[model samples]
Target: MPPPLTTTTTTFLLLITASLLLTITTSQDSDPDSDCTNKWIHIRQLPPQFNLDLLTNCSEYPLYDNFCPYTSNHGLGQKTHNNSHSWYRTDPFMLELIFHRRILEYPCLTSDPNLAKAIYLPYYSGIDSIKYLFGPEYNFSSQHGLDLFHYLSKTDTPSIWKRNFGHDHFLVMARPAWDFSQPISNDPPLFGTSFLELPQFFNVTALTLESRAYPWQEQAIPYPTSFHPPNLAYLESWINRVRRSRRNTLMLFVGGGGISANPNIRRSIRLECENSTSLSTHETGYGKLCEFVDCSNGICEHDPIKFMKPMLQASFCLQPPGDTPTRRSTFDGFLSGCIPVFFEEMSGKRQYNWHLPEAEYGEFSVFIPKEDVVFKGVRIVDVLMSIPRVEVRRMREKVLEMMPRVMYRKHGSSLGLRSKKDAFDIAIEETLQKIKSRVEEFAAQ
Candidate 1:
């Protein structure tokens, strides 16, 4: 150990320490907003081929009857009604564009990666993957990874990608994580590119609407709902309407997939709806005990009223597993203030850890194993109706309480009251925290 310092030396060291602490405090408190809003984002300006070019080649986009009308308003489709400007028939794939626009308007964007807590990789992975789905070739396989590697490996500037080996970067996947996962063997002619599988992206995190569970590399965000109220006032009004609305129906399911040849729980749900629903119930002022709006044509269409009506009037919404484990309808149920009854753990527990309180999930949502519903003949209506009335009300309130953060705000409209932090806001905050945790862990390794 060194000898004790003199008074002058000790005083000089104390002053230096105070200055360092002050510098750190100033930097950390730079956002002036809450600690949650302290994320300084650095958005990658990738070559146009990654985002803009893919969008410009709209001729290749064959989804939704070509030139999807829903692409208007930066991915929120046209207004659902002549009167409602806030609500839209938003296309499912519009989250990336919505997020990009939000980033452009973000308060604390940094030009230098050194000042960024997280780097947003604005590659339209969802848009790029769609082109591969209709392809007769696998050429788009590693092109993205190759170009991405070249871009991040540049020697002209300090490489942020090299700082944490991609842990500091993240991608927003509007589609499910599986859509970007390419199988090892193309012998089956896979429907996705190896964009997420490439070595360069192995450590990168993703914000996806649906995630591949087990070894999760992505975070699940809420699937966009049709209603993005113009302001907080509209949102408050809608909440009041949902709370005061008479719930005459016991349970509701609005999805088509019931008549598939493969194993399905919707078929059982359909049979129960057909056999158990009686006209007498409506006469008794209980309305339909159960309701189903068939949408087996491969879409939970963007029509808000058509979907929200039954959910609004029902105590529970049946969100059975679909082609994948997760469903967009679940988010719709949350927005409608209807308690969603999930059939798979992958559907909820493993997906929205960042958005929903995993320990308190039972307070807002219900989960019945798919095995019981599909194989053991557990009737969902019976399971749901068994929930006490007080409990049902409490669950509905919990859902509404957790609602605003799961949705994107109206595009380019700051005209109304908004949630303190909507889905876009939550995603950014969580992404920054996750990156910080990951980078620190990586450094220790």
Candidate 2:
């Protein structure tokens, strides 16, 4: 304070301050909650036959709906509104393609193979699973999968494949794990590519929608929901809206009317939904209205809003087991801040513990055993209304807190928002951790 500082000295001090500030800002932007791992991922852009070529013939893929429409816009489905940047008709089963698009802009992605902790194979195993079932490749063996396997086994391939003998490699499949697994005990041959069953692929970790059967190698990732927020601001605003939403519906059920193969369970649900709609004010106290979408004719009305709006107004959503024990509606309900009412343990936390490990599922979900609903004839409306109001508020708040991690960021775009980790970040972070552990456990000889 006694003497004025020289220009050179002042400039040097200023430079140091600026550098410190920049470092802080970068750290804040890169990792808001320290969920990002120090390791990087190298994405393998496989040949067209492995991914894009199969996508081109989307019709050959299996689904109840027309597959081509769902594959549009990098698996974001068709646009919903004029704002192409924010809105999309995102399909639940198109998770692999959405993850593929996200990896292109992953923050920790590295070009140098040595810098990566794990190698991502953007293989469209979902489409490939049913490709031979429909296309000219029908009756032929699953040669494409074998081709990918051979490509990885090649000596000229990246050293990442050779380092741990494919232990560090991972795949993100949109379908359930059983779709790629082989049938045992001389059972009727399951229509599969036998990809996960390959002895060479045993170490290759796969993140899938349903991992209940093969919990060791296959981890369950959240299903793709309709919403894909780019950053924290947009996501928070949506959460605020959900929080302030005057939920007028008591319960909501959106699925096929009664055409499910296991019709007895769904048939009972349909009857209850119909009965709930007719409940008198005395019978159903608060949040009296119950709504359901009879999607037997056309699932989800082919409109995201048609499905999302009901969830927004609902305090609880019915999540019965579909063809599989789990359904995308569970994620959709949570994302919309609607507490899910699950019928089976497998459909709830047992299968998707990775999605929200810290979540005490009972705090955020209502569990009514399948036997209670299907056999004992429990009333969904009465059970939902019986929960204390304070408890309902607590559950919805917990859901809002857990909501951000359930979404996949829109690729090649920026929203300039602030928030915790998203689905892509968590998936890659946990994946890299797994790969790092595997590499250390089985060091190369």
Q: State the C-alpha lDDT per candidate.
A: 0.74, 0.71
Worst 10 residues of 1 by lDDT: 7-16
lDDT string for model 1 (1-445, tens) is: 3334434334333543453344444555565365525477777767756765555544444442453465566666678888995688877777876676666656566666777778888777777776666543355564545666677767324477777778888988888877777854555556667666676677888888788765446888888877777677778888888899888888888887778666678888888788767535743345677888877674557777778888888888888887788888888898888899888888888888878868988999999987897789887767876778889889999999988877777744464554357887788778888888988888899
lDDT of 2 at 151: 77
Model 2: lDDT equals 0.71
Point out where model 1 deviates above 4 Å: 1-38, 62-64, 136-144, 155-158, 261-263, 278-285, 298-300, 412-419
Q: Estimate, for each residue in 191-254, the C-alpha lDDT of model 2 and write its tens digit.
A: 5555666677878999998875546678888888777766666776788888998788888888
Evaluated at residue 28, the lDDT of candidate 1 is 53
Best by TM-score: 1
